[model samples]
Every structure is written in C-alpha cells, then in structure tokens.
Target: MRALHIITGLGVGGAEQQLRLLLRHLPADCDVVTLTNPGAVADGLAADGVRVVHLGMGGNRDLAALPRLVRVIRAGGYDLVHTHLYRACVYGRLAARVAGVRAVVATEHSLGDSQMEGRRLTAGVRALYLASERLGSATVAVSEAVAERLKRWGVPAPRIEVVPNGIELDRFRFDRERRTRTRRRLGLPEGAFVVGGVGRLARGKRFDVLVHALARLPEDHWLLLVGGGPEEHVLRRTAHEAGVAGRVLFTGERPCAPDGSPGPDLPSLTSAMDLLASPSAEEAFGLAAVEALASGLPVLYTSCPAIEDLPAAAATDARRVRGGPEAYARAIAEVRAAGPGPRTAPPAAHHYSITRSTARLMDVYAAALAGSSPSLAPLGASPS
Candidate 1:
C-alpha cells in the first residue's frame, strides 16, 4: 500500500524517532512530509532511500501550507495518510480529507494531563484537537495512559487505539565489549557509577532534577545527559551550580544510531550506564525507559505509562519515584545498593517489538480502508 506520513517536524524526539523505527518495519511504499523544520532525521530518512518533503511552514499559524499539503496528498496517490504529533495530526487529517483520501490515521505521542506541545492545557487547545480528531479514521495512542487521556479529551473510546511504541530489542541488548568501548570513547570514568538520562534537554524532561540528584549521590556517581536542545545552557548552569559540572557529560543531539540506523546511537552508550532515570513530570510513553529496560538497566521514572504496562518480570528493574532530586537520589542509591540485576532483554520486550507494532498498524490501516467508522462526531463538538 502507498502511505504518506506527516509530522510537525523531523527533529530528534520520541515521536520522530519512533516514526523512523516504524518505517523500517512497515512494508509499504511510503513517503514523509515535515510541516516545519526538516531536521537531522530528514538526512537519516534520505540515507534509507525514503522520500522526505519539507513544507516551509513559517509558524504554527501558517495556514497557507494547507493547499500545498492537500496537493502533496493527491499527487502521491497514497492509499492512507498517517499523522504524528499535534500540528501534523490537525492539518494532515484535514488535508487528507480535502484531497479525497479516505483513510487517515494519527498517533498521539505526547499528550498528558500536564502539557501539550510544551504548553499547559487550555480550553482552546482541546477544542482544536476535538475538531481535528473527527477527520481522522483512527487515532493511535502510544500507551494506555495516552489512550485514557484522549478519551478525557472527548475523543470517543472506539476511535482511540492503544498501540504501544516499539523498540529494536537486538540493538539494545547489553554487551560487555560494547560497554568497554563506548565508555572509553565517550571518556566516561572507569568503574564510576553512571546515571544516564536520555531525551531532549528540555525543562519538561526535568534533567535539572537529575543534575541535582547526582549532587546528592556519592562522588563516584556521574551524570550522562544524552540528546540536546535549547535548554543546554540552562542545564549546564544547573550542573555547575549544583557542583556536578565536572561529573556531568553532555552529548549533543544524536539523531541517528552510530551504525546509521533510524534510531539514536544509544545502544552502545547504554552499556556504559549503571542506571537510567526518566524524571519527567509527565510521560505518555517512555521509549527511552523501555530501551534501557531492554538493555537490562535498572530504571527510575516519575511517570512512564509504557513501563507501567509491562509485566512484573519485564518491569522488575523499573521503579516509579516521586518527582524530586531527593527522591531520585534515594531511588538511585537504593538501586545501586541492590547492584545491577540481570542484563538481558526482558520477556515484555517482545510485546513492544517494532515488528508487532508494525503488524498492528497495518491492521488499523486495513480497518480504515474497509470504511469502518469507529465513531462519528460533528467537528468542534465537545464530549457529552
């Protein structure tokens, strides 16, 4: 089938990274469109021989791009249009329908009780989402929590499909040799306790809390901040103020895996970390936490619905902690005291494999193509 994937931007984030992985597993003649910044992921897609079109959307209110988007959809002759992120979901769904494409699917990647596009919830935003949601055939939620949030946002339950994010398990499996090499390459101290936090260095990620947590730990404990963003300067100041600057190492934005795969070059680095901490105040799905778990690292998270959904055996090493430096420090100390547990892929990993997620997505596509209207609602109507 011919499919076109639309996203707000092809930047280094969870949704974008997940899309990259999804494309590798999906068997379709697919192309991509980035509504705004065609960041590093564009290069990675091009390397993989995927067509990527960049729409120079000046800003969020750039409505002029709508006609261009509609043209792209029509010209591609796509059997289905799949959207990711909020901006893309709204505009892409509208464009698909206007272009006469019957099947439109969207993935809700980061909606939480606290935030949307890094902003707090407002009435206007909900109305906007509710309006756009009606145009799509199916709305894919990356986790049960996300699905629940959508229902609360007034999306009908039948329209929300819980398709958990998937990971490339083999790439993340722990390796002693890789640990040695990666640590040496990254200049991480030998035998020091490394607590890693992977994701965009944004305020929402709470990396500042991590730096503070590192300060309360032993001198041997160090911090590895993977990925980068506008908050780098602020985080550096935070690390310095916390007196853990020397102990903190920042690896600026890694968009693709070292082997040039769609995902980040995090697998090799995972081997070097003693533990992984995802202290974000809100997380719909914790892709990094799952990868760390798959890599066999103990995880301490504030809110990761994805990890919570895993079975006890798979989630044995992952713990939910309150959001604070003190709490995170205590959790890290406790996990350290317990020592590193098994470094093998958990049983739950299979449930979230990219292959399985791709199969489920295809099923969603088929259902949409079959003209299965899960529910119907007038545009801009709120839930009763």
Candidate 2:
C-alpha cells in the first residue's frame, strides 16, 4: 500500500511529532509520501528514507500550491492520503479528491470551538474545513474532546473516529542518571525545585501564564522554557516586566538530530525536570505531558477539556489551573507542596507506541479503500 501524509508544516509540535511517529512505524512495504517543506521534522523523515515531496507552502492558505499537491498525489499513485492539522486536512483532502485517490483520511488535532481569535479568518478556515471533512473518506480525532467538538461543527458521526495519541515507552523511559546530569549541566542549584515546559512560545500555548506562575512561586524554584516561536521576544519582555526574568531559563530552540537520528540531548532535557508545566489554553492532546509522565515526571496544566480526557492516573499528577496570574500561581504552589508521587510505571507500550497507532491507522486506510463505511469507535476505545 502507498500512503501520502500531509501536514501544515514540519514545525516541532505535537501534530508534527505524531506524524513522525506514525511514518516511522508504518508497514515496511507500504510506500510513504510526505508533503511539507524543510523544517524540524523534515530532516528526520528524510533520514528514515520516507519519500517527501515539498509543496513549498508559504503559509496556511497557499491555494497556489494546490495544483502542485494534486500533481504529486496523482503521480505518486497513492492508495491513501492521510493529513494532519487543519491546514493540511483542508487542502490535502481536497487535492486528494481532485486527484481521484481512493482513500483520504484526516486527523482533527484541535477543538474547533476553542479557536476564538480573528473572526474573519476563522470563518474562512471553518468553511474550508467543513467542506473538506464532508469530502474526506475518514476523519480521526486524537481525543474524545476533539471528536465531540468536530461533531458539533457538523461532521457526521459515522465519518469520525477517536484515536488517542500514543508514545514510545522505550524512548521515554525514566533515566535517573540523565536527569541528574541535565540539572547539573544547566547550573541549577542543588535541591532547587525545577518546573519545565516545552512548546511553541505562542498565544495559544500561553507561556506567559507560566512566567507569572513562576513569579509567584518561592525563590527556591526555577522554570525551564524550551522551544521557540514568534512570541519569544514578547514573552521574554513579559517575564522581565513580572520581575521573574532571572528565574526563567529560556533555551531557545534545541536542535534535534538531523535525518531521523535521535537527539542526544532530548532524554536529559525531559528527565531532568521535577515536573512538566503545560499552560496552553488549548491542545488536541498533551503529547509533552505524556512524555513527561512516561519519564515519571508529573504535569501541571490549565483545565482544558482536551487535557481532562487523559486517564485519571495521568490526570492525577496534573492539577488544572485557571487563566489568571493569581490562579496559576496558587495552582503551582499547591502542586509543589504536594510533590508528585513515586514515578508511575510507564503505560503499556501499545497505548502510545507509534507501531500501534500506525496499525490502527492502516485499518482505516483499508476500510476506506474497500468502499466500506469506516468503523469509528467511541473515544478511548482500544484498536480492534
């Protein structure tokens, strides 16, 4: 089987990481075509020998690239086309339909109702997304929260499936030595509480909330901010204004290994933290939180419905904070007072493993090609 995977961009984010994991575990005989220009995940896919066709998309609505996308899909003779993120789902599904591909699947990674900014732009994107969802052979949601939101937006239930995101336990297994070394290398004081967060520095992610929370915490604690984005400078200014600039360490964009190689620094970065703080106002699924949990680190997140859908044990380590600076600070203090329990045993490898996620995806692909209605189980159903 030949599969074509499309994504909005190759930026380092949850959806991009999910796509990378899925591609790596797809059946060896299944030829894969990746669509995205060079970015963080691109080099990794290329190194894995996945055939990639860059559409040179400059932004979200690159209609000019649609013809090129269609040409590539037709020329590749793809049996199925799977798209990740909203932009890719809209354009890729339409292109696949135009190219006459047998199966076109899309994964909805965010809640439609949660995106309230920019009314004019949101309306246009919604129209495009609704049309694409109607035309898609199958639609997958990463969480039940996401699925329900999609249904509310008019996607028929029969066409949608809820598939929780998975992770590689082996890769994220807890490492005490690495954790110790990472903290020491970063020059953190001994016995100092460390709270780390990893995500794009953007409005959606709400990194400023974390800075405010840190400012309210005792002077003995430190906040580690990883990843980079357009909001970096603004966030830095906010931290300075809050008088917590010295307490926050902004490690601008850590480089992962090129060409699919594992970055030597990732394990230490994740393992070193006492807890993972996810202040994002919205998320389709908290991949970083899962990674932290797999490493036996706890998470403190905002009370987004999507994050609430995680298993109770996973949620137990997490305390849902409200939006304001005071609420965030109070929640952080509460979680700190109640230190995380003994590192929980990692969840089953199948639950979040790339291999399992890809296998379930293949079932959807096969159903789409067989001209049968896709079997979409309820949110949290195990793959049959």
Candidate 3:
C-alpha cells in the first residue's frame, strides 16, 4: 500500500517526530510519502529510505503550494493520505480529494479550543477546520481530550478516532551507563539532580513557570531546557529575574535521531535527568513526558487535560500544579523529594511503540480504503 503523510514544516515537534517514527516503522511493502521541505526530520526519514516529496511550503496557509501538493499526490498514486497539524489537515484533505485518492485521514494533534491571535481569526480557523473534517475519510486524535474537544466543536463523532501517541520503547529504555556518560559530557556534576523540560519556548509551554520553580529549588538542582522558539529570550530574562539564570541550560533544538544510533545524545539527555517537567498549559499528548517515563524518569506537569489522560502509572509520577510560579515551585520540591520510582512499563507495547502505533495506523488506512465509516470508541479502545 502507498501511504502519503502530509505535515506543515518538518521542524522538531511531537507531531512531526511521530510522523517520522511512523514512516520509519511502516511495513517494507508499504510505500510512504512525506510532503515537507528538508528540515530536521526529513534527513531522518530519507535515511530510512522513505520517499519524501518537498513542496517547499513556506508556512501554514500556503495557498500557492496547493497545486504542487495536489499534483504530487496524483503522480504518486497514493492509496491513502494522512495529514498532521492544522495546515496539512486542511490542505492535504482538500488536495487528496482533488487528486482522486481513495482515502484521506487526519490526526488532530492539538485541542480545538485554543485561542489563536484574535477571537475572529480563531473562529475563522475553527470553521475551516470543521469544514475540513467532512472531507476526511477518518479523523484521528492523539488523545481523548483532543477528540472530545473536536466533538464539542461540531465534528461528527463517527469521524473521530482516539489513538494515544506511541514511542519506541527500545530507544527510550533505562540505561545507567548512558546516563552517566551523558551527564559527564554535559558538564553536570554527578551528584547534581537534573530536571529536564523539552518543548518550544512559547507561551503555551509556560517555561517561565519552570524558571521560577527552579529558582525556588535547592542550589544543587539544575534545569535543562531543550527546544527553541521566539520566547527563548523572554524565558531567559525570566530566569535571570528569578535569579536562577546560572542554574538553567538552554540547548536550542538538537538534531533529532538522524541515524537512529540509539540517539545517544537525545536519549542520554533525557536519561541523565532525574525527572521531566512539563509546565505547558496545553498539550495534545505529552510525548516528552512518556519518553521520560520510558527512560525511568518521573514527570511533573501542569493539570492539563492532555497530561491527565496518561496511564495511571505514568500519571502517578506526575504532579499537577497550577499555573502560578509558587504552585509550580511546591510541586517541584515534592517531586524532587519523591525521587523517581522504578520505571513502570507503560501499557502494551502497541499502545506507545512506533512499530505498534504504525500498524494500528495501517488498520485505519485499511478501513478508510474499504470505505468503512469512522467510529469513535471510548478513550482507550483498541484500534483493531
């Protein structure tokens, strides 16, 4: 089967990373097409021998690039088209219809209730997204919270499917020696405790809360902020103002697991940490938190819907804090004192592993190809 996956930019993010994982694990007989210009994840996908079609979409809402996408989908003769992110979901579905593809599916990776720049603009986008839902043969949501939000926004329940995000367990497994090496390479003291946070330095991520929480922690505590965004400077200033600037390390957007060589740098980075902190006010699925748990590190996150949907064991390691700095600081101290428990293996490997998740995704593709209607099962229902 030929599958075409569409996404906005190939920048490093949870959705983009998951797309690459799906492409890499798809069956050898399945042809995978990725539509995005060369970026961080492109090289990784290409390295896996996945055919990538770069449309050079400058940014979201590129009307000019629609023809190129439509043309490519037609020429590739894709049996199924799966799209991620808002822009790709909208344009990819429309283009797939234009290309006469048999099935078109989209994965909703964010909550629909989020307010963009202005109320009017947000409403318009929501309307457009709702309309696009009709074109999709099926709609997949990374979390139940996200699916519920879509239903509340007027999407038909039959078209929605809740598929929790998955990870590569082998890649994120606990490794003591690798942790030691990573800490040593990063110049961190062996005895120091590291709390890592990975996400864009944006408003929704709430990096300021993390910086403030770090300020309240003991001097021995360290914070590692991985990922980049427009708010990097603002977050740095917040740390400086909070007097914890020296304690925090900002490693801007590291290259993703390009060659998949156990990604010593990426996995080691998460493993070296004693815990992961996700202060985001919004998240469709906490992929980073799951990665941390897989690496045997507990996580402390905000009381967001997405984090709440994590498995009970994984959620137990997570402390839900309010948005303010003081609440975050208290939660940090509590988690630090608790230390990380023995890494509880998450549910079935299929629930979160790339190989399993991609197989389940193929089932969705098969149903779509057969023209079977979509079904919205309960939060944890098996895709099979």
Candidate 4:
C-alpha cells in the first residue's frame, strides 16, 4: 500500500528514530513529511532512499502548513496516512481526511500522565488531542501504559492499539570487540563501571538523578548520558556540583544506531556500558531500558512498562528501584557487587523485535482499511 508518515520533526529523538527504523522495515511504498526541522534523521531517511519533505511550519499555530500538507497528501494519492508525535497527529489527520484518505493512523509515542512530549497537559491540549484523535482511524500506543493513559483521557479502548516500540535485535546484540573499541574511544578507564542514561536531556527524564546517584558511587563508577537538550547545561552543573563532572560524559544526541554517521552509534555506546539506569518515574515504554536488556546489560529503572508487562522470568537482570539518589546508589552498588552476567539478550528483547512490530503494524493498517478497530489482547497478555 502507498502510505505517508507525518511527524513533528525528523530529529534524533526516540520517536523520530523509530519512524526512520519502521520505514526501513515496512513493506508499503512510503514517504515522510516533517512539520518543522528536518535534522539528522531527515538526512538518514534520504540516505535510505526514503522521500522526506520538510513542511517548514513556523510553529504550532502555523495555519499555512495545513493547506501545504493537504496538497502534498493529495498529490501523493496515498492509500493511508500515519502520523507520529503531537502536532503532526492533530494536523496530519485533518489534512489526510481533507486530502481524501480514508485510513489514518497515529502513533502516540509519548503520552505520560502529566505531560505529553514535555508539554504540560493543559485543558486546551486535551481538548485538541481528543478532538483531532477522532480524525484518525486508529491510535497506536507505544506501550500498554500509554494505551491506558489514552483510555483515561477519554479515547475509546477499541480505537487504541498497543503496538510497542521495537528494536533491531541483531544491532543491539553484545559484541566484545565493539565494547573494547567504544570504551577506548570514549576515554573510559579500563576498569571503570559505566552507568548509562539515554533519552532527551529533559527535566522529566530526571537525568539529574543519575548525576547525583553517580556522586554516591565510587570514583570509578562513571555516568554516560547519551542525548542532548535544555537539561544538558543543568545536568552538567549538577554533575559538577556533585563533584563528578569529570566522571560524567555527555555525547550530544547520537543516532538510534549507526546510520553511517561520523560519531559512534547507540549500539556502540551500549557496548561500552556496564549498566543502564533510568531514574525517570514516568515512562511510556522505557525504550532505553529495553535496548540495554537487548545488549544484555542489567537495568535499574523506576518505571518501564516494557519490562513490567513481560514475565519476570523473561527479564531477570532488570530491577526496579524506588525513591531518589540513595535508592539508585544502593541498587548500583548491589548490581556491581553481583558482577556482570553473560552478554546475551533475553526473551523480552526478542518479543519486541522490529520485524514483529512491522507485522503487527501491518495488521493495524489492514484493520483500518477494513473500517474496523483492531482488537486488543488482555492488558498483561503478550501480543501474538
């Protein structure tokens, strides 16, 4: 089927990178439209031979982009339109309908309890989201947590499909050779125990918690933050204040996986780490933790529906820690004392494989085209 994917921007964030990965695996003749900045991800799409159009939207209030998007959709004669992120969902769904596409699907990549994509959930935001959500045939939630959040926000259960974010299993598989090279490249000490936190450097991500947690650990326990944002300076300041500034290494936004880019890819960075820690109390899918598990690293997270949804036996190395820096410090110490296990992905990682997600998405597309909502499995049940 001919399809078009719309997103707020093609940057290095999880949703943007997920879109790039999905496009590679999806069988449809697909193209992409970014409502604003077409950054590295846009270039990556171009390299992959995918058509990407930047809408040049001035801001959320840019009305001119509506007609421009409609024209693009109409000209493409796409059978279906899939939207990602917030602004694109609200505007892309309407434009696709106006352009005469009957099937429209939107993926809610980040819909937390109090915020959606770092924006506070104001009344108007909910009204707009609910109103525009009706324009799409189905809303795909990245996890059961997000799906439940959508339900609480008044989205009908039947219209929401839980299609978890997926990872390329082979790409994340542990490699001893890669581990040595990556650690050397990052200037990590030979015997240092690296703790990783991956995501936008946003306040909500609570990366500062990791910085503080690092201070409580031994000098050899280092913190490697992968991603960049407003919190970069704040986190750096926190690290310096904690007197672990030299221990904290920030590699400004790296691609999902090496897209033949200059810097090291995420997989290489994962290879360099001893443990992955996500202190964010709020998480939709907890994608970073899942990727770490794929790399066979023990994970310490506060909230991760990806791990929580799976059977405990499936992810034995993942542990959930509560409270603040003290809790994280103790957990990190315990995991370190336990020493590293075999670097092999668990069953949980295979469950969320990229190819599996593509097949499930194709099912959602078929259901949308057939003019019916996709049936959901039991809340805790594994998706078939």
TM-score of each candidate?
0.95, 0.87, 0.88, 0.95
Winner by lDDT: 4
lDDT of each residue in 180-252, candidate 2, tens digit only: 8878888888887888888777777888878887888899878888888789999889999989888888877
Q: Please, what are the lDDT tens digits per residue for candidate 3 over residues 1-384?
A: 877888876766667777777666677343334455557677666776777777877666567777787778777777888888777888888888777788888988766356422123377788998887788888998778788888888888987887777777877777889888888877887688888988777777888877888888889989999888889999888888889888888888776654463222467788788888888766767777777767767777773454576556545566666667788777777777876677554553225676667777778777888884442211221111
Residue 123 of model 2: what lDDT?
A: 66
Total backbone clashes of candidate 4, pairs 3 or more residues apart or in separate chains: 0
Candidate 3: 10-residue stretch with minimal lDDT: 375-384
Greater lDDT among 1 and 4 belongs to: 4
Query: Candidate 1's C-alpha lDDT?
Result: 0.87
lDDT of 3: 0.73
| Order by TM-score, highest first | 1, 4, 3, 2
The C-alpha local distance difference test score for the whole of candidate 4 amounts to 0.90
Model 2 TM-score (2 dp) = 0.87
> In terms of lDDT, which candidate is stronger, 1 or 3?
1
- lDDT sort, best first: 4, 1, 3, 2
lDDT string for model 4 (50-96, tens) is: 99999999999988898899889888989899999999999998888
Where does candidate 3 stray beyond 4 Å? Answer: 28-37, 58-62, 115-121, 258-264, 303-307, 310-314, 343-350, 372-384
**How close to the true structure is residue 129 of candidate 4, measured as C-alpha lDDT?**
95
